[model samples]
Target: MAGKAPYIVPVGPIHPALKEPVHIELTVVGEEVISADFTPGQTHRGIEWMGLSRNPVQIVHLTDRICGICGVTHSLAFARAVEQIADITVPERGDYVRTIIAEFERIQSHLLWAGVAAHELGFDTLFYLAWRVREEAMDAIEVITGNRVNYDIIQIGGTRRDITEDQYDKIRKCLNTYKDLFSKLKKLFLEDAVIKSRCVGTGLLSFETAMAYSAVGPTSRASGVTADLRVDYPYCAYGDLDIKPIMPTIYGSDVNGDTYDRIVVRIFEVAQSVEIIETCLDNMPPGPVIWEEKVAKILSTCKKASGEAVGRHEAPRGEAVHYVAMDGAEAPISWKVKASSYSNLHVWPIILKGAQLADIPVIVASVDPCLSCTDRVAVTDNGSTKIFTKEQLAKMSYEKSRRMMQ
Candidate 1:
């Protein structure tokens, strides 16, 4: 063993089967991997920097494209940043709408992530089942926001559309349906022996290591790291909900920070999201959904105004931090984004060590990596990505109105 050499296996930014572009270098000694490295490949698009130079009006749209799954979160974060800089206090109704929309986005994102994790583990049936339930959240969002992905509903001072009494009822019913579905899904993920066998004791991320890497979301929660922006740093309607961050506890066995724990944490969090949304809907106050006067005043002014502010949102993947610096002159001078995935990526090596080759994708997907493309879910890089044009979002809005008529 004195002069033995290790093999460097290079994976890709465009692997044959992977849906996203990632470059992974695995240093292996025969069948066992000694170390591993991962990069975004050609994924970074610099949308954040572009926000800094564009007018504040356009930055909201640009921010929407930061991540397909977390589009609403990005928009909200940017809006919050701009609102803070302009010293604007959004109306109470605007706060409620923002909170409702954010929680809806969280529900869909977590469900999509659960399905993706299952698909990576070769559980195609489970993937389909999870997505089936997710459609409920998606349809609710489409009904409320006029689009499934990039809602384009959030504006600087308030939301664009107001939630009517009938629309509120529709949302509550949808939440009820999803609550029952998620309960069953949680049982399957936790009690199923087959899932437990593959997931348990795989990818052990210790609590200390998680803190060191500054892991975010369920990935860090699985390791018992108590970090949640919703609780620690409340925003919008979160302060009213009294939501607590759910953490895992040691069971009968050793606290193995494996795939099982990650799955459990996400499943539990999904329920928490559902609860939060319902609370927002029930306690929703009656007022103008937006600060119409304030918005009209800002839009009418052609003069440029700017300031510096930082906005953070609890994205499905983790805590997404957006740093906005405006010169108080033109649109904006610069914008910077630090997504949770950016930080969680550092924890990969620590968890991946000693994990089996077959478990690689499952473990990676469990972290809910947001390898953002130019478009949303429909528009794949292989000409398969489907994105709704402006016209389509408008049409969807009309359809929702028609549904209410029925």
Candidate 2:
């Protein structure tokens, strides 16, 4: 046993375990993981680089393509940033509409993640059931935004579409369906023996460690960190809604900060999203959904805008932020995005360490890492990829700033 050699196991760039292209290096002693490391820039799309050449109005549509599951997340965040820079106040009805659609996005995203998690754990029947139920949310999204995926409903100052009274009944029906299905979903995912056995004590992340890594969304909530942007820093009708962060303790269990706890947090958050949507609908304020109806006017305002501001939203994954700086130009001088997965991905090595090799898939899936949204920069020199150290990146950033100033 003393002379037994450690093995280096590589998973992905393209692996069955990972939904996205992320290379994970695991140092293992037999079945147990000794240490783990992951590289995320494998799927960088350069969305930010593209945004620098487009106006805020054009960039809003580009944001929708950031993540397939989070249809409104990026657009909403980007819109809010541009709105802040242009000093455009969204109408009350517009705020309510944004909140409603964002909650629906939460419902579908969580269910999709649940299905993936179930599939990773070899629970194909549960996987099928989860995705099947998720369609109701998708249908409701289509009913409101007229698209199942990439709902281009968000505008620079407000929404492109409004939830008319005729659409109310359809939305309510979908909410009622989820209300009925919620309990069954809880029982099937939480009370099942196999799920409990595989996920209960596996991939534990302590609150201290989670905070140290700056985890967000369900990943942090599972670790008992009460840091929901909806509660901490309310935006887009969240200020009017009475909502708190969902913790695993809601399940009548202490915070274990394991894969199961993450499951519990997300499952309960789906119910929370349902309540939030219902509340927004009930208190629906009557007004125009867009601040400026003319796209040309919105563009003109953005072009005249000369300031910087950050837009933060409690996306399904966690807090998504967009920083925008404009200087009387057609495009922003700077546009940066920080998706929730960026924060959560840092915890992978911590959680994967000491975990069994068999549990890698579910554990990785548990965090619900959206690498496409997280990856922003990928440096390649003449066809060769480059991985820069922290110090090197810092120095390069400083040099770039100086060149820009000159």
Task: Tell me the TM-score of each prediction against the true structure.
Answer: 0.86, 0.93
- Candidate 1: 10-residue stretch with minimal lDDT: 373-382
What is the model-wide C-alpha lDDT for candidate 2?
0.93
Off by over 4 Å in 1: 1-5, 250-255, 293-296, 299-304, 373-406
RMSD per model, one decimal:
9.3, 5.5
lDDT of 1 by residue, 307-333 (tens): 688888888877887777766565666
Candidate 1 accuracy as TM-score = 0.86
* Best-matching candidate per TM-score: 2
lDDT of 2 by residue, 1-406 (tens): 3667899999998998788899999999888898999887877766887788898988998999999999699999999888988999999999999999999999999999999999999999999999999999999999999999999999988999999999999999999999999999999999999999999999999999988999999999999999999998888899998888999999999999999999999999999999999999999999899999999998899899999999989898999999999999999999999999999988999999999999999999999999999986777899998988656866887898899999
